[model samples]
Every structure is written in C-alpha cells, then in structure tokens.
Target: MGWLRAAVLGANDGIVSTASLVLGVAAAHGSAQSVLIAGIAGLVAGSMSMAAGEYVSVHSQADSERAELERERHELQTDVEAEHKELAAIYASRGLDPVLARQVADQLMAHDALDAHARDELGITEAFRARPLQAAAASALSFAVGSALPLLMVALTPASMLLPLVFATSLVFLAVLGALAAWAGGAPMGVGTLRITFWGALAMAITAGVGMLFGVSG
Candidate 1:
C-alpha cells in the first residue's frame, strides 16, 4: 500500500511536469519540433534534479543521524548510570510507573543499551534510517517514468491538437494516479482524483499563461 502511494506520486510528478512543459510551449505558438524538444529537455533535467536533490537531502539526514548516534554512544560510555536514569525517565513519561520504568530501563540497558537509546531517546530506528544512494536512484527513476508519458503523447498526436490533447490526457493521468494513491492510503478515491486533477490543471494553466505572456512580449 505504501509502495502504491509512492508510485502514484512519482508518476504524477512526471506526467504533470512534462505535460505542463509541452503545453506551455504549444500555447505560446512554438513549433511541434520545439515543443517536443522542450518536453524531452524537461524530463531529463527534472529527473537529474530529483536524483541530486534527494541524494543531498538524504545524505544530510544520514550524517545528522550518525552524528547523534556518536554523541549518544559517548554519553553511554562515559556515564552508564546517568544514561540509565535518562532512559527510565523517558519510560516513566510514557505512562510507566517510576519503579517499573527503572527496572525496565535497567533490563533494556543490560541487554542492549545503545540500541535502546538510539530507538527511544534519539528516535532513530534501524528500519527508518536514510539511504542516500537508494533514495536518489528511486527518485530519478520515478520522475523519468512519469515524464515520459507526455513525450509519448507528443510523438503520437498531431500538432494541431497537441495542446488540448496534452492538457486533457494529463488530467486523466492525474485522476488515475490520484485514485490509486487514495485507494492505497484507504481514502476516498473521488476526493483524491479531484484533488490531484485540480492542482494539476492549475499548474498547467499557470505555466501556459506565463509562456503566453512572455511569448507575445518576446
């Protein structure tokens, strides 16, 4: 279900971005060749941007987590008793009685003090740890897949109907993606569909307006 939601979001970005690019160009009276080229450029640029951005962002997160863990390890090593009291306090605050919390904390520290502190005190679980390379690759792949749709439409549709078809088909694609996302998340599919389509339409309209305003002025 989570994967479905993620997949929907990734494809939505690709479709909306590429479709908006081509539509803006077409609306501005660009030639078919020009529009096609713009869409392809956008897909490539956007994919690389997503990849780089995700890598930097996730790498920073990983670094922060590592730094925190090192600090926690130092604290644990220097003052085991203090660390035990801190863990007990955390448990007590979470509804355990003071005596019980102390006992539990003692047992946990005896078993795996670092793991307990990392999970409870720092909120850094092994399952949720950041992987920069994996994140970057996934982001780039998703963006590329989504962006390819509008480019495919450009190849198949006549130039005369390019703008309308891109606009219309992009909306349809968004609707489908939204519905899938909603279903995966266990929300109302219609609401999700409307929400995504509305935003997608707004984005395309704004970009088209920008292109037209400048196209005429240029």
Candidate 2:
C-alpha cells in the first residue's frame, strides 16, 4: 500500500501536468502537431523528473536510517547495560510495567540485540525501510502510464475538438485515480475525488488563462 500510494501520487502528477500543458497549448491556438509534440515532451520530462526526485528524497531517508543504525550498533558494543536499560525504558513508556519491560528487553537483546534496538528504539524495521530504487522505478513507471492517457486524447481528437475532449477526459482520469487512491488508503472516495478534481481543474484553468493571454498578446 505504501508503494501503491506513491505510484498513485506520481500518476496524478503526470496526468495533471501533461493535461494542463497540452490544454494550455491548444488554448493558445497551437497547431495539432504542436500540442501533440508538447504533450510527448512533457511526458518524457515529467517521468524523468519524478524518478530523480523520488530517488533523491528516499535516498536521503535511507541514509539517515543507516547512520542511526550504525550509531546504535556502536552504542550496543560499548555500553551493553545502558542500551538494555534504554530499550526497557522504551517498553515502559509504551505502558509495560518496568519489571516486565526489563525482562522482555533482556530476552530480546540476548536473542538479537541490534534487531531489537533497531525495531524498538529507532523505529526502523525492514517493512518500513526506504528503498530508493523501488521508489524511483514506481514513480517513473506510474508517471509515464498516467501521461499516456492524455497523450492518447491528443492523438485521437482533432484540433477543433482537442481542448474540450482533453479537459473532460483528463478530469475523468483524475477522478478515477483519486477514487482508487482513496479506496487503497481506506480514505473517503468522494472526498479524494473532489480534492483531486478541484486541483486539476484549477491547474487547467490557470494554464489556459496564461495561454490565452500569451496568444492574445502575440
């Protein structure tokens, strides 16, 4: 679900940005070829950008986790008793009685000290650990897939029909994306749909206005 959520967000960005760029170009009375080319370029650039951004962001988190774990491992080596008490304090803070917490911490540390401390003290677990490559791939793939939808509209619709068709269909795409994301995350589908659609609409409107201004000026 975490990866799914990231993919969904990346897709949403791809759809909204490509759609808005194409619509803006069309509004400016750009030729069909011009808008089509613009959409393609946007797809390529947007996917790459998403990939790079996700990689950098997630890599930073992974770095922090590594540094913290390294420090914890050193502490465990130098001050075994202190680390045990620290782990017990954590368990106590979570509502366990001090004696029980100490006993549990002792057993856990004896079994696997680093793993226990990593999970309990630092809140770093395998399931939740950041994987930069996975995030980059998911973001890039999802963005390209989402951008393809709007590009298809550009290909099929004639110049005269491009603006309305693109806008209408992109809104539908966003509504579906939002609803699916909401369902996956156990959120309100209607609220997600409304929120995503509203932002998409606003972006398109702003882009169209800018294009009109430029078109009129030039």
Candidate 3:
C-alpha cells in the first residue's frame, strides 16, 4: 500500500510535469525537435529527482525504525523481568485479565521476546519497515514510464497539430493514470481520474496562454 502510493505519485508527477513543459514550449513557437528535447530532459531530471528524494526520505524512516527497535531490544536485554511485566500490562490494558495477560506474555516472550514486545507492545515490525532502495527504484521506473507517453506524442505528431494533439492525448493519459492510481490505493476511481485530468488541463491551458501572450508581445 505504501509503495503503491509512492509509485502512483511518481508517475503522475512525471506525466503532468513533462506534458505541461512540452505544451508550454510548443506554444512559444518552439519547433518539434526543441519541444521533444525539453520534454526528454524534464523527464530524465524529474525521474532522477523523485528517486533520490524517495530514497533519502525512506532511508530516514528506516533509520528511525531501526533505532527504535534497537532501543526496545536493549531494554528487553537489560531488564528482562521488567519487560515481561510491561508486556503483560500492555495486554491487560487491552482488556485481558491480569492472570491471562501474564500467561500470554510469558508464552510469547518464551518464543521470541523482542518480536513479542515489538509487535504487540510497541506496534513495530519488520514487515512495515521502509525500504529505501525499493522506493527509489519504483519512483525512477514509474516516472520514466509515465514521462515517455508525452515525449512520444511530441516526437511523432505533425508540427501543425502538435499542441492540440499533445493536449488531448496527455489528458487521456492523465485520466488513465489517475484511475490506475486510485484503484491501487483503493480510492474512488471516478473522482481520482477527474481530479487529475482537471488539474492537468488547467495547468496546460494557463501555460499555453502565457506562452502565446509572450510570443505575441515579443
């Protein structure tokens, strides 16, 4: 679920940002080759930036989790009896009777003290820990895939129709990407899809308008 969010966001940003950049440059009377170059550059830079950012952020979270787990392990090692009692108390607070809680805690501790405390007591586990490299790779790959669509359109479309073609095609892609993201995150597909397409349209429209105005002034 966590990874899903990161991947979707990376792809969405890649698509929208690159598409918007190409449209803006094209509106400013740039040639197809120039627009394609700008789009490609934006795609590469954005993907690398997203990956590095995700890596650093996830690594920080992982480090914090490790520190917390280490602290818990040390506490368990230094004061075994106290840690056992603390675990029992946690169970008791969660509605178990004192005697039953003690028995359950003792049984769990006997099997794996650190695991027991980390899971039941502190709500920490290896499963939920962040993976920095995995997040980085996902971001990079998703961004690259998303960015390629707009670049392809710019590369193949006739110059006379480049702007309109890019706008229409990019909107379609944005809506699809949004729906996919929503589905992956267990969200309402319609709202997510519409929301993304609306923002993307607005961004391109505004940028195109500004570009045209500047071109006219010049």
Tens digits of per-residue lDDT, candidate 3, 28-146, equal 89888888999999999999999999999999988887888899999988999999999999999999999999999999999999899889877776777688998898988888888
> What is the TM-score of candidate 3?
0.90
Q: TM-score for each prediction?
A: 0.88, 0.96, 0.90
Residue 149 of model 1 has an lDDT of 81
Best by lDDT: 2
The positional error of residue 167 in candidate 3, measured at the CA in angstroms, is 1.8
The residue ranges of model 3 lying beyond 4 angstroms of the native Cα positions read: 93-98
- Rank ordering of all candidates by TM-score, starting from the highest: 2, 3, 1
Candidate 2, after superposition: displacement of residue 135 in Å? 0.5
Candidate 2 at 38: error in angstroms?
A: 0.5
Q: Could you tell me the lDDT of residue 58 within candidate 2?
A: 89
Report clashes for each candidate as comma-separated counts: 2, 0, 0
**How do the residues 58-100 of candidate 2 rate in per-residue lDDT, one tens digit apiece?**
8999999999999999999999999999999999999999999
* Each prediction's whole-model lDDT (CA): 0.87, 0.93, 0.89
Best by TM-score: 2
Model 1 lDDT vs. the true structure? 0.87
Question: Lowest-scoring 10 consecutive residues by lDDT in candidate 2?
Answer: 1-10
Candidate 2 vs 3: which has more lDDT: 2
Give the clashing pairs for model 3.
none
